[model samples]
Target: MRRSPWATLTVLALAQFIVVLDVTIVNVALPRIQTDLDFTADGLQWVISAYTLVFGGFLLLGGRAADLLGSRRVFLTGLALFGVTLLVAGLAGTPGALIAARAVQGLGGALMSPAALSILTVTFAHGRQRNIAMGVWGGLAGLGGTLGVVAGGLLVDSLSWRWVFFVNVPVVVALIAATPLIIRAVARRSGHGFDLLGSVLSTAGLLALVYGVVRAEPVGWGSAEVVGCLAAGVVLLAAFVAVEARSAAPLVPLRLFRSRALSSSSGALALNGASFLAMFFLTAIYLQQVRGASALRTGMEILPMGAAAILVAVVTPPLVHRFGTRTVQLCGAALSALSLLLLAGTGADSGYASHLLPGLILFGAGVIAVGVPAQIAAVVDVEHHEAGAASGVVTAFYQVGGALGLALATTLSVSRSHAALADGMAQQQALVEGFHRGLLVAAAFAVVNVVVTLASPRIAPSAEQIAEAAATA
Candidate 1:
């Protein structure tokens, strides 16, 4: 008997959820890991950055592989590699060993993510089924981020920081076992050579850029090391563009940017990521540092945002249907910006219910609103055969944007806090001032998202219309 499409979707979603959950699960455990491993203040960040840099850098290549090779094979291989790397990371005793393992885990994630999405794209026929599948995919992606915080808090408080990585082992095992039964085998494309040159240039370029930005707080941006890294990154990225323009088989087809919807949606995703990442980082610190909450309490305080986001995600489809994707996206962006502004005003003495709850709820709702519509618009106009590539590009931008935002926020917050400390302010007051600055920056990014979303073309296909079109096609 064949597996139902819904079953296939569920399996794919679970795989993706596991991959995304790792992104935030490690945040709550960072302090614990630092104490255990004796990591330097700057060294601690590498734990997260190592994973993101490798994941973002190799995503395009991974997507292309799924298209040229078989998605199922790549998916299984990725899962196996990810599981192994996670095991190594969990068992790591030294900071160097953990960072290396994290980099390997990221490489595995880069492979798995695109392959999983490609499977979903091919498994579900376009129309109502595809829409529903995408909605579930987006929701799970959002929920994964939330779960990371809560799960990390629980594991870090009870067991050990290593449990965060150890947890992925069982999930990967289950997915690998079930994948063959759920996913249909597809023919591989022949005569599609991998764009080795383009991949090298792009990956190296992105890694260099991220490394430079992340190092700027410890090594001043004006320092020779920082400047050299930034310059090398720019030059390599420029070479990558030149290589792509001339290559017969490019890793990322430069022409895809010609699509107005894809371009707009990608831009919106970047801005959304920038704001959302900053919001999460600053709020986590604010809850812990300024309010003097424990890791568990801080995680619990942010639970409302996660719950609100899930609820809003459930209702987004109908809202999009009624008012159109553009309207909802713009509204969501506006709300997010407002929430950021509210957070920007929060002082050291501010109460969670009076100052934080309203902003968090508004931000959560806005994030879900922007997330669903932006994703819908991204693939709406993409070619069916290139769905994997398209999805990979979106995912890469999302991760890259997040990394950049966090790096910037970290630098800004630290600088502000140091300056306030120099001025004889209390530690809590200095931290709150730094958080306010960070939230203000997040608000500015949210405003940018609103403008970009408004520039996007309308997406208002009814469920019946979509189903009819899919059936006819």
Candidate 2:
């Protein structure tokens, strides 16, 4: 008896949901974790940054592993690692221990995310079903991020902060049990040896680059540590590309980017991620600092945005099918820009119902609209053999983009606030002005994505591409 495809999708989606949820869920619990574990104010940030850095760093390697070692093998291995790390993190008595666990969890996430996506790409035919699946996948990705705030607040308020980590344990256990029943195992690919040099270069380069970027705002970007890391990362990545071009069994085949759809999708996803995360970051500040909302209240306020995203996610696939991918994506980009513009227009006296709610709703709708189509486009042209690598590439772009965007927003917002204060402006007025500037920066990112989307070749599948996609399924 064969398992239903939807069942397989459910298992995969749940794995992805937890992976993404973990990224943000720990945020609300950070203060509690710090209090309990005696973390230094500086050390406390590692709780979030450790996971992000490792997850982004190893994604490429994880994806390629799925291709060579078999998705089922990698997926299960990642799930087990993730589950054990959750336990360790929850029980950790010191900051170092918790940070270490979080770092390892990031590695597990790196493995699980790409493997699950690779499976999805091959599981469904590239048509309406695939589009719908991508929408659900994209929606859940956004939803997980949003819900993390709410769930963390509720859990930390009612129970202990450890519950944030503990809550996912049962879900992971269930997924591990269901995975073998639903997803059939495949033999590992033969004749293709791992590209150890490329993997080392790519991983080191990404880790350094992400570390530098994340540290830039806290420690000046021009500081020796950040500069050295950025320089080293760029040099190492360049070497990695050179090595990949010549390697017979390259970790990431250089040829994958030749497809207009794949390349454009990668760029578009980066900008989309930049705008989305920047918007979230700036809005959180606006609510908490400007409006004097509590952490729990802030999460509750953002609920409408999540609701809007869910609605748009359901409708976006059909919109893509009807209006075509480019048109739909352009529309999404437009909505994102409009949302940012609305946010930029907000002032200290603006009311949530009148000023914030509408912008948040549009943002929720806009991001999903752009993301689902862009995600679908990313893999539509790739061969099944390289699907994992392709998935890894696009996902990596989104993560890195978010990190870069948030860093930029923080730096600019702070700089602007300081400048205003130096000019004798009131602190509240200075902060609001700084936030407005940050919102515009996010809007600029959205506008850039619109141009990139418009310039790319349309993603309508050719008959040959459609046939290839069908064969993959």
Report the lDDT tens digits of candidate 1 across residue range 41-137.
Answer: 4456567767876787788777778878898898888889999999999999999999999988988998898788778878878767786787688
Which stretches of candidate 2 lie above 4 Å from their native place?
Answer: 1-10, 27-49, 91-100, 117-146, 177-184, 214-221, 382-388, 418-434, 461-473
Span of 10 residues, lowest total lDDT, candidate 2: 464-473
- What TM-score, computed on C-alpha atoms, does each candidate reach? 0.89, 0.83
**Candidate 2 residue-wise lDDT, 1-473, digit = tens:** 78788888899888988887886677667666767899743345467656765676677778768878998989999999999999999999988899899989988997888788778877887777886676577667777977987897788778888988999999999999999999877556566677778867876786677667656655788999999999999999999999999998777778999988889988888888778777776676577667777656777887788889888876876666666678889999999999999989999889889999999999999998888778767777777667546756777777667656665665677677878989999998998988998889999999999999998767765444433332222
Clashing pairs in 1: none
- Sequence-dependent TM-score of model 1: 0.89
* Candidate with best TM-score: 1
Query: How big is the positional error of residue 392 in model 2, measured in Å on the Cα after superposition?
Result: 3.3
